[model samples]
Target: MLVLKKVQGGESGLEATDLELVQRCLSGEQEAFAEIVARYKKLIYSVVYNIINDKQEVNDAAQEVFLRIYKSLDRYNPEYKFSTWSAKIATNLCLDILRKKKLDHVPIEEIKEVSSRLDTPEDEYINKEKSSIINQAVSELPDKYRIPIVLFHQNGLSYEEITEILKEPMSIVKNRLYRARLILREKLMPRRKEEVL
Candidate 1:
């Protein structure tokens, strides 16, 4: 039974940078790996969930990502942020799973909407409906566009980071995101008009 340790300050009572944690893990500190798992579990899970869209597979995929990270630690380049590297691993794994399983359709209901406090029930309902519409549009995008959108908007990764993760040029990443938004706008325009009418 492996336990995830709480992320904490290093032995010097100061926060450890990700590089330092990786170095510690490389130095045979098992607890360091636990710390890494604890730190990145949510990120891995979110990336997996967004791509896979299957709640039942998310936990297993996240665990597999951690295993891959641990196994590939030696290949990690210190030039990149560990989080970025881990995200790349998660993204690749999820994409591979998608390819293998032929699972590209993400249900709108599975895409959790971020809710904010509203003045009335009507406002909340309208907000939820709009979110659902947007998510549904996004889900319909081609994988090349959709992956970048999820990474940029949902995962909050920078264009440069997404470029690194996806192994695409920065311009391509930016263009994909642009195209994705354009596609979404086109898809939602009629709905917006219907609501207004």
Candidate 2:
């Protein structure tokens, strides 16, 4: 059995690298694969939720992503970062789900509010409203623009990693991200003005 002991202030406090976990998992240690799920479940959920935008579908899609990951472990390349590879799988799966369902206008109200210290309930409400507006704008974005922005900003993937996952040229990834930002700015500017007024 592969055991992971907790340590302070390091990557999930697990001593084993992702490759090590995968190796152990391949060696028939089920716990190692469980550990991998525990480590990355939040990430997979975030990627799926951002794309699928429906809370009901997010859970099913995330579960399916993990199942796919487990089945494809043998094809995992040691040269690449495991998180990147797994994110690519999640992204592709979510996209496939979207294509199959032909979903339109999914609401994004389920997006978690970013917590911060607020001096008053009014401030908290304002913050949440702003976040909701932002998420709404993001959800309205075209998929070509939305996917790159979500992977880059929301998921914190690097341009190179996104390029790899998206199989687009570096210039295309950068361009899409830039255009997404511009579109978001345009979408949010009127809201900002209304608040000021």
Candidate 3:
């Protein structure tokens, strides 16, 4: 997939950003839709799976997520942040599905995995404890908190940019970000204290 090129650090020749792919799709290039979906597949799937916590529901949500994207491609407003828009759609859909199914709730201690970053020496394991704790705390956030935190930290989006994607008041975004950090600190405080800030 062209997105694998993104993961491979630009070795592949995709030669476009996701917005550009949307542009092509809007202009009647249906094939371009596939490229855009491929680009975001991993991220979208990961987010959906974390919230749903059911394999079949996650898979169905993943497909429907792409379907919504495809159907909404015509209305894709380039002025807004794409990833935020995508996240909002995914989050709402998951919530709606949850309610419609009347699913029984389970324990919330979901253990999500992080993709391995650069390896460190064994001696540095303890040194990395704070970073690991912060990540785990973040992973535990409710979808509203977790999604914003992931977008801010993992996707490297600025607050203004995130504001557009979420279509949420900037104040709400800031509150979520602050609460997410505070929650992380509290969660990690007892375990370890280094590199928290």
- TM accuracy, model 1: 0.89
Q: Between prediction 1 and prediction 2, which has the larger TM-score?
A: 1
Error of 3 at 10 (Å): 21
Ranking by TM-score: 1, 2, 3
All candidates' TM-scores? 0.89, 0.87, 0.64
Model 2 lDDT per residue over 19-63, tens place: 888888788988778889878888898889888877878888899
Which pairs of residues collide in model 2?
none
Please list the Cα RMSD from the true structure of every candidate, rounded to 1 decimal place. 3.2, 4.2, 6.3
RMSD of 3: 6.3
Best candidate, TM-score-wise?
Answer: 1
lDDT per residue as tens, model 3, 1-197: 34543312133664677677777777887667766777778767766765566786778898999899888877877777677677667767876876787654311223334546755575356545545555567656766677677667665567986677667899999999999778877887776544453
Cα lDDT of candidate 2 equals 0.83
Superposed model 3: Cα runs more than 4 Å off: 1-20, 23-28, 53-56, 98-136, 139-144, 193-197
Instruction: Assess the local accuracy of residue 48 in candidate 3 as a C-alpha lDDT between 0 and 100.
Output: 72
Pick by lDDT: 2 or 3, better one: 2
Q: How many steric overlaps does candidate 3 have?
A: 0
